[model samples]
Target: MSAINFTDVVFQTPRRVCHSIWDGLPGAITQTRAMRRLGRYIYRRFTRHTVRTQSHYTQFMRNPPLLDVLARLLSEYQIGSTVKLASIGCSTGAELYSALYVLRRARPDLKILATGVDISSEVIKAAERGIYCPGQSAATNGLYLEGRPELFWEDAKALRDLFEVQHGGTLRVQDRLRKDTNWLTADATEGGLADTLGPQNIVLANNVMGPMDDSLAEVCLRNVMNLVEPGGYLVVDGIDLDLKTRVLATSDFKPVLLGQEELWSADGSKDGWPWVRWGREPLDRTEPTWELRYSIIFQHARV
Candidate 1:
């Protein structure tokens, strides 16, 4: 019994097991047609554990409200030269690219340095390539596995100036836009942000830790925080309210509300375009906090 392989019973389909046996059996054993039929059975069991997330496009939300806040900050501070920005969990580089586009549009004279980091290598590569197509390249890496196809079309339209669709149905980002974008692979749960990516003026740690347990999320949140420079901006839009409250209880940086303290945002720029914001002000880190107040104006807080 110890010699028997149980992969067939546990997960692999019957056809997969049969093919394995057929190849392993001695050449003297005749391969029967019945064996082939049995090998073709196509059912397999799935693991109960949740699968890892795939990288996805930002649904062409190239105009995130976060950009508006950052712009206001930059202008207020009179930032003349280079501005460093990092997108934590930058799935497929959409968010990072969007930031770059905004900076270039708002402050063309300033040089924009952007880095994108994600846990999934597949998604990182996709982000690096900076290419997409509704029919072919959109789902190339299995991202947006459950989202509808029409959404890609809508996103493409929203970001038309940034990318061009080829005759063969592949979308390519403009070379000018792709020049300054850098891609990195790292996990926030592990504290390598310092070595992998040095401190940044602004860090976007969005959409990763919110779903996890508080203890685990805290560890990951610290990892993300490590990437932010002193007095710098860190966007924690993905964390749950409870986790945010607990984690910020000890930190010196204030909590900035993005999109009225909601998971998703809308700035009313377009019918479907989503927007983001950053609001933060604490009476005292050691003292209690106050109620949620939405504000569009972001004062220049240069780190």
Candidate 2:
């Protein structure tokens, strides 16, 4: 296998498209060129589309047991009162909603403060809509459905007729958001996250550490640990478990693996968009590469 070369495309395609689209209809080709360059830089220089595409693709992917993995992780955490779970860089709210679904099923009584953080206004708005593309229901596996879609669909019609407007279809879920769950928009750096979440019972930094600055990662973990009360747990994705080991060693925590077997079939890791990661590396498969191939659950040791 060889590395896929995106460099040529990165350098040439954007200009070609820029010339093709904004060549005539522009007051400022200079500004359009700059914007197009920035767009190309984002899309080509990194795995920008991977997360967006994965949110939809997971419905079709057979290998990744997302709900099961989450259930295992939550069960391992054994969350209690004042439980807080943050999914850093949670784009489009799939992973956070997925966790919410599992938590609602496994421990409905637990007071959950689920916060989803993202930088994109468009994606956040999509999340607020909460009406997944009919396929997201697969990720839920019908775990915590309060009523049939028919019932909700009827309510949507009634609301439309009574109010003479369309407002409360899926967006109603955002309104019905538990007092504990919040959607925040902020940059992960600049101390925004440090202020929002504190010593959480379970903090999910899954797939976030790998893409962020090391200092940001440290601050993020430190914030979670600082907020975490004694006996509280911090859950991180195993993809960066090795790096986390180095970082955690300096802090006051120990590694506890939430087994990968139940979460992943023995043959190989299942495929899906890593709700918060770049793309999976080609050489990622090997013995117990749950974090690389699937999601891994880890608990924070004391302090």
Top-TM-score candidate index: 1
For candidate 2, give the lDDT of residue 97.
63
Model 2 CA deviation exceeding 4 Å by range? 1-80, 134-179, 213-227, 238-242, 262-295
Error at 71, model 2, angstroms: 4.1
The residue-by-residue lDDT of candidate 2 on 33-114, one tens digit each, is: 4444443344344433243222311111122354455555556444565467776655556556656656666676667778
TM-score of 2: 0.52
Off by over 4 Å in 1: 1-57, 77-79, 135-151, 257-303
Top lDDT prediction, candidate number: 1
lDDT of 1: 0.56
